[model samples]
Target: MSAEKTPGISAIDTTNFARQIVLDFEFAPVPKQRQRRGLRNEIIEVGAVKLDYHGNVMGEFSQFVQTEYTEGVAYPVRELTGISAVDTAMAGPLYVVIKRLSDWIGRYSAQVVCWSGADRRQLLTECQAKHIDPAAFPTDWADLQTFYTSIMDVGSHGCVSLSDAATWFGIEFDESTGHAHSALADARVTAKLLKQVMDGDYRVSPRAQEIRQRWGGWASEPRRAFPRSAPS
Candidate 1:
């Protein structure tokens, strides 16, 4: 669904910070043998949406990065992200792609928002591997997944997937732009979800509420240890 038709999001407020960036990454799947050889999944795609304080779309950035996988993109990864080896083969190197992304973000004082902490971790790992200065990217990063869980008082220790959270808020994926797993699609959805939370127009599911109540709030109940049985 379009942002205008998204529920729980009202008219722009035109207050708060200057801009916020919603970001997502797609990683190439590493085989078990390669993983054993100290190879980690490399970022194949980067997608982001820049929004104003009022949640209006300012701009977007999307790029694909070539990977070191000589065997070409893994079948599963290609299937999941719809990014083929040909795509990465024709794309720029990781360092080049990241540089372009940093340049696109410019000197604007904007906070980078991602669906979860994993994206930040992945970025750090890749940057370190490429010897690219992480400082090139915005340091002010926020995990929207954590924020959503904490605010909804549900799954605070874990997280709801971006698509699941969107579904909970009656937000539909705009397939015309991209599919569910595509980085851009996910980032766009995340932007919408963030707007809903900021507007305080989202709802916590009844099931989530019931689960929290049964668990005596959002905190997890400690497991009771059974005493060892005496030998008969």
Candidate 2:
């Protein structure tokens, strides 16, 4: 790890971050017919791809999580994620999946990576609601969007989506991941992008200041113990 450190956060070690476990989540919203909902966006899938220090894939984790939604899967969610109610019907509960994921991730001394902050926020919210200890999550993380914008010297508007990022890296989007919403597929793609970024000496460009400002400010170091509860 580099000895260099950013303002309030620990050293912005791209190399170290790339070696960490990259994760993603696919959540299903409660059916619209329900006037009352348990969780706003209930997690239906959890996926992760852990990388070694050289950025090679070391292992992976993927699972369909059962939600408490009695309405079954929403039509739109099924259409978007291709995850039907029946798929999650016999899957393990959210708490159980979370526990298994925690054990898998706890074995490493690496950070977590994702294309955006949405997955982290969702994990925090779900864990909080289920009374699962959020502390098991790795404190360090890298938001690929922010890093990509910086490395490419692109301004905020130039930020690329996951599929776009794959194209930029010259990596084919694997169709086997079960469409774009497949958590494991998405995580795999994110891992590839991480490798590209780590292989270079890219740093967040000064333009990133503007984007960070829009989000309030640069995320606190080690990030916050948890992000604000995910949007309703």
Model 1 CA lDDT for position 218: 63
Best by TM-score: 1
Off by over 4 Å in 1: 1-17, 31-39, 153-157, 203-232
- Which residue runs does candidate 2 get wrong by more than 4 Å? 1-19, 31-39, 153-158, 175-178, 201-232
Which digits, one per residue and each the tens of the lDDT, describe model 1 over residues 80-111? 89998888999998889888988888887767
lDDT of 2 by residue, 7-107 (tens): 22232344434357888888877655642423578789888998776667888999999987545777888888888888799899988887788788765
lDDT of each: 0.69, 0.66
